[model samples]
Target: MEPEWIQAMQEELQQFKLNNVWELVKRPDPRKHNIIGTKWIYCNKQDEHGQVVRNKARLVAQGYTQVERIDFDETFAPVARIEAIRILPDIMHSVCMCARFQAAPKESHHLVVKRILRYLAYTPTLGLWYPKGSEFDLVGFSNANYAGDKVDRKSRSGTCHFLGRSLVCWSSKKQNCVSLSTAESE
Candidate 1:
């Protein structure tokens, strides 16, 4: 492995230690018990200009090899994306696009997600605040994309609700039925 990759691996191990990622246990008999395996996923961190910033190494489980009920009862990967809570229109668009392709995400999608996370980490004040004296004025706005998804030709619906000038709620979901025209989509 390259030096950068080694450094990244070390950092990841450090994080695992700091976060209490695992418990030390006696080695299980290979013939009696199925021991889970893990793999290292490596990626190149990049900047907006497409320049390589650093290396990122993620230690992930080879969960596909494990039996569903015997090896694990239930499986869930919990991730917290802070940008989803904020009402930044640009960020939401990027986040929504990333989520749409999360199953088989490309390198570009990964870069976009990294950018969104970095933005949220540095500049953290783009948040909605409900003040006590703020007048109650509920306003809602909605829009739809006609045949937004090129694959299925499914239209997308988005809505934003605001109390006075602060945005409170927002949602974007793909329409169930494909609409031939924009008028039908609305």
Candidate 2:
């Protein structure tokens, strides 16, 4: 029987191939083009009491070696952030993406990831709860941070919609235009 980690890796690769995640092409000349390396990350999912619940493996592109224009174009991806006093999967995805983009995600990124993992372990069964026959009122909340991103000097805005105390939709994104004032950003 195959080891659990190996089986998990095989499953991940199989899904990628089935989904047409990438195509196989002749290796580009080393002199002209830079071919990014790939790595397999193995992790064990743990429950609230620290018991191993599942074995997981992920194949990730080595983004550090990638050049901005030559290897990839844009880094912006739509991410959703919901503020319902609970941690959701979208926040984890966002954090992972952010760590991937960092040129050197050394200690700080590792610490952040570990913190998130610990939080997940502490709340394994937590999830959004929407009671039936609850109030049907739709409420929306939005806020913007002026020049939140120091590197780009762009404002960031986030909005969340609630349907009777249950979060339905949410989005957090950097503003397209630079805001001149806090009022404009808001």
TM-scores for every candidate against the unseen true structure: 0.36, 0.35
CA-only RMSD, every prediction: 19.5, 22.2
What would the per-residue lDDT of candidate 1 be over residues 42-126, giving only the tens digit for each residue? 8888889999998888777776554342222333343222222222356545665687687898999889899989867865766
Error of 1 at 35 (Å): 0.8
Misplaced by over 4 Å in model 2 are: 65-186
Over 4 Å off, model 1: 65-186
Indicate which candidate wins on TM-score: 1
In candidate 1, what residue range of length 10 has the lowest lDDT sum?
78-87
lDDT of 2: 0.68
Which prediction has the highest lDDT against the true structure?
1
Q: State the displacement of the C-alpha of residue 42, model 2, in Å, after optimal TM-score superposition.
A: 1.0
lDDT of 1: 0.72
Supply candidate 1's per-residue lDDT for 142: 99
